[model samples]
Target: MAMAAPAMRMASSASFLPRLLPPTVFSTARAQFLVRQLSLPLFPNFNIAIPVGISLGLPSLPEVLEGIWEGILKAVPKKKTSHMKKRHRQMAGKALKDVTALCVCPACGGMKRMHYVCPTCASTHPADIFSLAPTPSTLISSSGSSSLRIHDTTSPTYPLAQTITNAHKLGCHHLATARGPQTGNIFASVGFGGDVKIWRQNPDSKEYELQWDLPTVSDAGKGDVWAIALSADENFLACTTSDGRIHVWDLAAKEKIQTYETGGGRGAAGGGGSFAMAVDLSRDGRLTASGHENGGVYVFNNDAGRMVYSLSGLAKPVRAVAFSPGCKRLAAAGNAGIIALYDMEHGEHVGNLSAPGNRPSWITSLDWNDTGDYLLSGQLDGKVKVWDVARGACVATHSETDSALWCVRWLPPTERALGPGMGKGERFCAAGASRSLSFYREATGI
Candidate 1:
């Protein structure tokens, strides 16, 4: 009776305990099996059967609980995450994205992404074209070096056609070439050694030969010759002097023709020292213009053999002066960065083109395209800007290098096909301290 009572009580206790658990994990079948196992004898009698896990000495209930408690202890938090560590995790997804930048090329009229070159044209130069002169087949470039490199303008590659070794004994700083309808195959180079020498292509050898030299003692001495220009006929040469005198020589006769003096030249007492730095003869061989260190620009009439217009408004050293193809307008700029436009007919200050509210480096060189439509200016910041004459607006800007650009010039118009969608617009070249020549084609080209 006592055994029956204890078994009945144990059975009641087991049944009641199962009711306390949720039914999902421990179903009715599982509760019944667990109760059957719990009702078994604590120890085995003789030859009694035991479950395989118990006979194999599997872990006891208390030992299993102790292992679980140890696992929980191992999972405890170690340390707080740092702010920087959290930030890195947060930014991981947002950091993976492409940055697309775009730029419209001034020369090719092609739209391209920034930080890339034009896909159509491949132009390069060995040295800066300190003074660029157009020729029949290529461009003659002179830098601070003695070698004069001729670049083929017809091909997009701008291959080097000829190199005049030791063209200037002391390194040529300026080069001038003219092969227009009125001019023959003649070019001029002025060197730092203080001498001027004219060259012509030898018909038989197809190489340039020294044709003439200027008298000097010293060429780089008092009233030193600073800049030179040649007329379309190649018969007249104009050069600037430190004393602010522009001397014209008849190249054919090798005689001094006329000298245009700025009233502010060193010859005048209390007159601001005039240092003529740049000179250019009109394409028609009618006018001569010179820029001076005294911020003065002078236009001289070739036929009249006198000064015509003395332009102002620069108030700073004028580094570059250029005339329009039609000989009607003149463009001048220099240390002031503001490009001053003047009328050759009325000799009046017509307009000015400048970037407002921005710090500008010195304007080193200027060239007017053959069409007289766009004016290209290269600055010390290694940036080239194309200014529209009609609208007086900066149309395109190329910022390729951070070095100073010494010169820039427009290439002659050509109908030759370079590549698809290329060769339709005006093209120009720029060179400077970077020692690499860069050519940009106007998107207007075919």
Candidate 2:
């Protein structure tokens, strides 16, 4: 009986053998076999019975291994990535494009990225463009470089029609062309060195040639000339000087014909009069108007050979002045950023044209359309505005750059207008510190 007791203990201890072995290496069948082998050897007379099925109070090897694999799978993602999530991950850390980084193309009249070479047109001057003048069929541009460039306005590409190399040794600042018929054959340019050169188009070849240069010594008080204007007949040239004197020269005789002084006898050494910044002649060749640095506008009767009116109202330096085609109204603007309209007949302050803003940009240049219905103005803030003269309101505004605008001009109407608003044939060009000329056409629904 004592031997049988030891066998019972052995069998009871065998039940825990499965728990001691690794779950992968242990099984229910192996547990039963071990118990039987140990019990039968200890007591042959005792009836040793081993259960076919045994419970170790734990999961089996196969069941435990499967449960462990399922837990590992739950730790990882199961669903496929969505399209939206994948796109977001791909686009992360990228910057959005700016909406205002665009401008109007000068050639094709389309939109393009600002400061980038336009795909439609890739034309530019080597240096800053300071002045722009338009003839009936050509557009002339002068820059800080010593060359004068002429572009064919009649062509879409604005192809370079002519290039006058070494036209000015010290760069050109101002250029003037006749505004009416019988004057397209001649033009004038003022250089930084204070010399005025006249160019005449050849009658047979249709090319411009340097006709003559005004001797600097012949100027009033030996002062430098700044602005110039030509008469409709192309027979007379009027120019402003640093000594606050306006001189009229007869081109046919090649001599100074008339001298109108604004300095009131204050010699050139006595701080002369305020510098005359701009000048223009009436279409009929009857009136001459000049704008000065002291914000003074003066009108003279060329026939009477005397000062007609000393205009007022502008408090800042005057930079530009123009007479309406009809010769009834005069428009002037300057650092004040406002356009003052004066009645030419009575020399009375009529009205003002200004945009809505607290600090408006300095007006650099002004021009009237052929019909005198609209006025075109270029500003230092890189803005060009068209004001309706009748309504005294700005009709259109264009901002294609952030650089200063030095000059703007309305291109003469062509026989066959091509772009939008062709029925009206209204087109204009602007140039400035950008060193490129930008052309814009009136927008129309068509």
Candidate 3:
């Protein structure tokens, strides 16, 4: 009985205990069968790579390296920027020194900007240094060293405040300034080396600093360039070559706009024989006046892009031709030393601005003041004489230089003077071969 009771208790305890789990339950007999079926005994006994070759493809070492390099390169990131900063230093109201220009004379030390004052001696006496321009301040002069000078007209001693050097290699022979109600202060210069330099002032400042530079269209050389002129609005620049070619450049668009042949065979004729000598743009930018060595003056119409008039009055080599402020009259002069005023409206030789006693002695330079009331002529004998056009009289004769005067210009009246209720008249500037520039204004206060 005792054995039976213990057996029953053991059976009950076994029933209450949990069943034990097997460690290899996942290793089924079917899985083992599948693995054995997939096994390849030949490849396993030989090389594993043989089966890899059959399964995939073969590749050379170089090809593998190249592919690896391309993959690495593709995984790299690209840089988005450089080291340059966005902001820069500003130029304040600090006065710039070295603003003065020095002109050397044969006997004396350096001359001031006007060449009218001796800074070393503080002398005011005139030394007959050079014939001053009609209104000197606005007159900008250039030299062989490639520097441009602008003088102030308001002061009796016109002082230079700015200098733009390296304007061109060789030297500058011709320069022109634009005068318009909107764009009055811009100017241009041409060098013997066939390069043209255009200059403009900063609109925000009155300092008149260098603003931009234009590239040369022709190869750099002396004979390739002869003269340069700017339109009244400064939108165009016209340059003449010794080969008798005229190239018109669009300054605003910075491109070559037009070209015209002056008639030439290179080296066939003398310097002026085959090429154009001088070119001038009228006030309205509608007409272009060109003076040739053969004493031919042709007026080109900008709108028509054709020669409208060929003047026949002057037979002497026409050196300089200028249109009046109104563009109604044209003044042509040169080796003849005579100012022939023409009427563009009627295409007639209206009158002459030459004085009664003035002889034919190379009238190298001519300019009409802003008012068009006076005419300025510079002679090879270094005489700058202003003529009254209305009366055809020589109003003022200033012979300050014996050196040939190369260029002459009238400074436009200041805004204050040009404003309403102001009566300030007459101002101009003249530059010569003597390496000096002079400025002059009608002695309104003196």
Q: Number of the top candidate by lDDT? A: 2
Error of 1 at 438 (Å): 0.4
Runs in model 1 lying further than 4 Å from the true structure: 1-129, 179-184, 218-222, 265-273
lDDT (10s digit) by residue, model 1, range 1-446: 95676657665755565464422332344444555566555312212233333322123445457758988998998999898877797689634444456666555677754433444443333455577777756778787777887777666556566888888766777777653643438988888877888998888876678899887564333466779888877888898877787889898999888978687653332343488889999988899999988788999898998988888889999999999889889999999988999999899999999976577789999888877888999998999999999999999999877798998888776667754556566678787887767777767666
Regions of candidate 3 where Cα sits further than 4 Å from its true position: 1-138, 204-223, 264-273, 356-359, 415-423, 444-446
Candidate 3 per-residue lDDT, tens place, 293-364, comes to 777777888788877887877777788888888998898998777888889997788877665664657898
- For residues 340-437, write the lDDT of model 2, one tens digit per residue: 99999899999999999999999999999999999999999999999999999999998887899999999887667554434446789998988888
Query: Each candidate's TM vs. the true structure?
Result: 0.70, 0.73, 0.64
TM-score of 3: 0.64
CA lDDT scores, all candidates in order:
0.76, 0.84, 0.64
By summed lDDT, which 10 consecutive residues of candidate 2 come out lowest? 263-272
